[model samples]
Target: MADYVKDIRAKVGHMPLVMVGVGGAYIKDGKVLLQERADTGGWGLPGGYMEYGERVEETLKREFKEDAGLEILSYRFLTNFDQEFFTYPNGDQTQVLTPFYLVTAVKNQPAAFDKHETKAIAFFDFDHLPEIHFASHKKILAYLKTLL
Candidate 1:
């Protein structure tokens, strides 16, 4: 409990500073890649917080590799955001993240491995997106409808 509090205190020190991230509709065969959060076991796109000393797009590229085991060809901004809220089953609270990206797969590829961050990674039809952890993801997908 003390550790979590200390971490929250340190994060708060970054004032008005929340996490920025990147994720996308990695579409193939008219379907998109989706992930289930290991912590919550709910569905979401594969992404994580932007790391220090890394370009935002680079973060997306790296996280795609780390979380979904895919290499991105090109990614453009879907939107920049300033909203997200979080809760943990163990009572840990966190600020939700603002994410950006409209990405597509590079080359004809097969699923590799993203061993730690994700347990399941697969493609799903847009109209049939599975029940996901984050409700915001459905909104994100709706936006993708405009793009694709």
Candidate 2:
């Protein structure tokens, strides 16, 4: 969690808060990169919450580096989802609003990833995507496929 979110949670204590977040679809060749999350043990796009005064693109770049060890070279806005309510494993709840992106270029790519929030990273063909962890992410990908 970001320090901003931690500070808010310290005050609110599991109360549902509306938060802004960012994520990206890094499609390479014919596959999209997905992170196997440590928290849910389910595959989803690499992303995280925005910190105070940080731009959405900044958050997306930071999250990709922290979660998957990839350096985002360039990205474009994909779509924004309506607020989606979600509960954390620790009982913290949030109404998350996400801005999704299409990562166009990157570097420092790795074949395997093991991080605090991510268990592993791999690319998957759209038709054979893993069980997605978030409803919003599933919706985003479903919508993205129409453009591919």
Candidate 3:
């Protein structure tokens, strides 16, 4: 997938950029933090693209703090990811190459940001799932089950 993204960058010679994001488990007493993507109005792990000169870990920290409104202690690299393009109702595409990280947060029930891009945010358990924003994301959540 990395190769594919590199190929895209090389082929386009323009910023057909790859986007990465970090989603933490933030498990405390059996809960996980999630955010509803404003794009699809589905519950999803919080993450965004890797910024210029920024590390993957930094991206995770910033994204977690921004979307979940929490201070996180530490995180582990859970997986390297590739998700299919998501098309909006307007027919625009949000194509991305995603990196997922599982982090532990300092707070349990953190208050997330109320913003244009996030419709809702909360914690979800194993038995429950917020309407997932993308099909590939659901696979990521499913992969998480094996880790537990």
What are the TM-scores, per candidate, against the unseen true structure? 0.78, 0.92, 0.74
Choose the strongest candidate by TM-score.
2
How would you encode candidate 2's per-residue C-alpha lDDT over 56-94 as one tens digit per residue? 899999888877778889999978886788998899988
Preferred candidate (TM-score higher): 1 or 3: 1
Model 2, runs deviating above 4 Å: 108-114
Which candidate leads in lDDT? 2
Which pairs of residues collide in candidate 1? 43-133
lDDT of 3: 0.67
lDDT string, candidate 3, 66-119, tens digits: 776776777777767675566556544555767777775465564666486577
lDDT of 1 by residue, 1-148 (tens): 2233346546554343345556766777888888866767778887776666677787788878877778888877778555665555654455656566867546458756566677888889888888978766767777777877
Total clashing pairs for each candidate = 1, 0, 0
Misplaced by over 4 Å in model 1 are 1-17
C-alpha local distance difference test of each model: 0.70, 0.86, 0.67
Clash list (residue pairs), candidate 2: none
